[model samples]
Target: MLREALDEANNWIGKVPGVVMVGEGRAQDGSPTVDVWVTQPVSLPQKVKGVEVRVRNSGDIQAQ
Candidate 1:
């Protein structure tokens, strides 16, 4: 199910031109878990369709 969620997230990011997906994982030492972050323009309107996953230390997701 994680892959499905990630794939869905990637689809939304793909809509943006010149957008890149960056994924980060955690280590056995339990240091930190990094995730994919999409670099989009802040000026873009909310009219665009896509899912949003928040990168937080506590692991929270917000989809639209």
Candidate 2:
């Protein structure tokens, strides 16, 4: 599911001018999670777009 989201995100890149993707991760509330932050220029009126996928098990985290 995570890979699918990334693939979709990749397809959006270059098609939208002034768009950039940033990756981030964190462990909060005793759960591990990953996020993708898609940023665009503020003047363009589009705010940051993003997706977060929770890492369910240790195996899932290892796979990433």
Candidate 3:
């Protein structure tokens, strides 16, 4: 279920500006979550497909 939610969340990448990365993770309470990393603050939903969406502000990312 969480995997499916993560897959659905990945679809938001590129479609939303500032979004750099999307992956699966565990929330503070140990519940499943979809992690979203962005270069700057952007509007995002609190949850997707019943799973929590955790958004973090990560300055611009560069490939090494």
**Models sorted by TM-score, best on top:** 3, 2, 1
lDDT per residue as tens, model 3, 37-64: 8998889999899999898888768989
Off by over 4 Å in 2: 22-50, 53-64
- Of 2 and 3, which scores higher on TM-score? 3
Listing every candidate in turn, what is its Cα RMSD in Å to the true structure after a full C-alpha superposition? 11.5, 11.0, 1.4
Model 1, span 1-64: residue lDDT tens: 4455556546664455434543444446743332444444322232222322434232333558
What clash count goes with each model?
Answer: 0, 0, 0
lDDT (Cα atoms) of all candidates against the true structure: 0.41, 0.38, 0.86
Per-candidate TM equals 0.34, 0.35, 0.86
Q: Which runs of model 3 end up more than 4 angstroms from their true locations?
A: none
Q: Per-residue lDDT for 1-64 in model 2, tens only?
A: 4455545545653245444442335546643233333343322212123445422222212223
User: Model 2, residue 56: what's the lDDT?
Assistant: 22
TM-score of 3: 0.86
Q: Point out the higher-scoring one by lDDT: 1 or 2.
A: 1
Which candidate number maximizes lDDT? 3
Model 1 C-alpha lDDT versus the unseen true structure: 0.41
> Which has the better TM-score: candidate 1, or candidate 2?
2
Rank by lDDT (best first): 3, 1, 2
Model 1 scores worst on lDDT over the 10 consecutive residues at 42-51
